[model samples]
Target: MPRTALFVEIPGVLIAAWAPDLLLPNVGIALRRLRQRNVPVIAVTDHPPVEADEFPDFTERLQRAILEVGGELAGVYAALPDKPASWRKPRPGMLLAAARELEIDLPTSWLVGTDNADAHAAAQAGLAGVVLVEGVDPPTEELGIVVATARDLCDAPRVMIPRQGGCWHDHPQR
Candidate 1:
């Protein structure tokens, strides 16, 4: 089987809140299961610059939480520095950039995100599938599958068997 890669949007997917200390649920269980199955889980998010004077601790905390969860973050890509102002999600830049940095085959990978636009970006980037979390508006076009929970991604036949006791949360939009 071709190796599977996961491109997750952190702000609204894995974490529930960032301010007043991170309030991440046990989403790590799902990630840990993926890791056990040899699937590479990479976080591709658009966060403020690490050097931002206003929120110096934001990046650090986020990284720490991701690490605690066993996620292999592919480095947060900033649209301001790396690409033109026109580059943003719904555009394939972030996803493509992460794929390149991680040296993964984009066309054979799975992109799971809370936003429907991410599904569009995944399609544009030629990803194998886009797993959209339930409760989000369904994509008008065929992007990929709609999963009820983040753990459902692991249950997909193409991915891995669903493990019990994985954390499930309805992540709020940031």
Candidate 2:
């Protein structure tokens, strides 16, 4: 079985709404379940440099929240403000970086995004598959990319687990 690493986008996927820092419904419960199952989760996000500088401890706070809920945050990688366009979801820089840091095989990994472009990017980056949260329609034709849908964040792991087997770390190959 191939190892599965979860690459999530924070603001829309994990965070409750489009507003200021509201956690989406059922996020905590879902995260706990993923953790109990030994899944690795990494937040691949894009935040303005000014926000990072002004808040300073924002990333730490996000990581702490995940820890408090029993989920292991492999790491948080944000796109540089200066290079915003290149670091956005359709681009795979942050996802690639997380795979390297987590020692996850991109070809066997899975990425869950709040939208289509994010999922498409993961597939483009060589991930085995991508999961789009409900409400976003997947492409009519497969682009050599496997796609799935989670009714919401709570359903994401449930949707991903059966699709992606055990972590590659547990296998002898790595």
Candidate 3:
């Protein structure tokens, strides 16, 4: 079973989940909420591309996993190429490419992941911002930005706000 962490919604005020696996507990309500709001939803990841047949099986499995957990599947964006500069985390290239291909405005989009790389990518790609999930931390002193968890992001203030707060090392909690 997968674990879910809720994240902030974009322009449509929807809800999203971030998990290593697709199935999650208590995600049904959130998925239904997003559906009720008619928001565009998707899953973003750094997985490399697979062959056509394999990709379908993977997508089907993912969809089934979501449904099995009582969650809805708006869509998923995977199959990123293996080039670091083009598809790696912290680059924003793969995400930007996906946004363009999907016709989603980068500014109104949210990137949910479990690392500073994803956060940096969101910042670089003009996303509303990133919702950093639990269990990953990059040195805050080195990286100027630090996001806590998915739930923290959902309740974050509206509008694009810069991180002018204390550095990661400055906080005792970190």
Computed on alpha carbons, the lDDT of every model, listed in order, comes to 0.57, 0.69, 0.48
lDDT of 2 at 145: 63
Off-target runs (Cα >4 Å) in candidate 3 are: 1-22, 48-53, 67-71, 79-85, 138-148, 151-174
Candidates arranged by lDDT, highest first: 2, 1, 3
> Residue-wise lDDT of candidate 1 within 60-148, one digit each (tens)?
67667766777545455544454654347788887777766767676556677777777777778877566665357657765543322
Specify the poorest-scoring 10-residue window by lDDT in model 1: 165-174
Candidate 3: RMSD over Cα atoms? 10.1
Q: Which stretch of 10 consecutive residues in model 2 shows the poorest summed lDDT?
A: 165-174
Q: Note the clash tally of each candidate.
A: 0, 5, 1
Model 2 clash pairs are 3-167, 3-168, 16-22, 16-23, 16-24
TM-scores for candidates 1 onward, in order: 0.68, 0.80, 0.60
Per-residue lDDT tens digits of candidate 3, residues 1-174? 111112222212222233323334344555555445544456555642344456567667666765654455556655334345555666777666666555655554555566676778776776645555454554364333334454332332222243544321122210
Name the top TM-score candidate.
Answer: 2
lDDT of 1: 0.57
Candidate 2 CA-lDDT value: 0.69
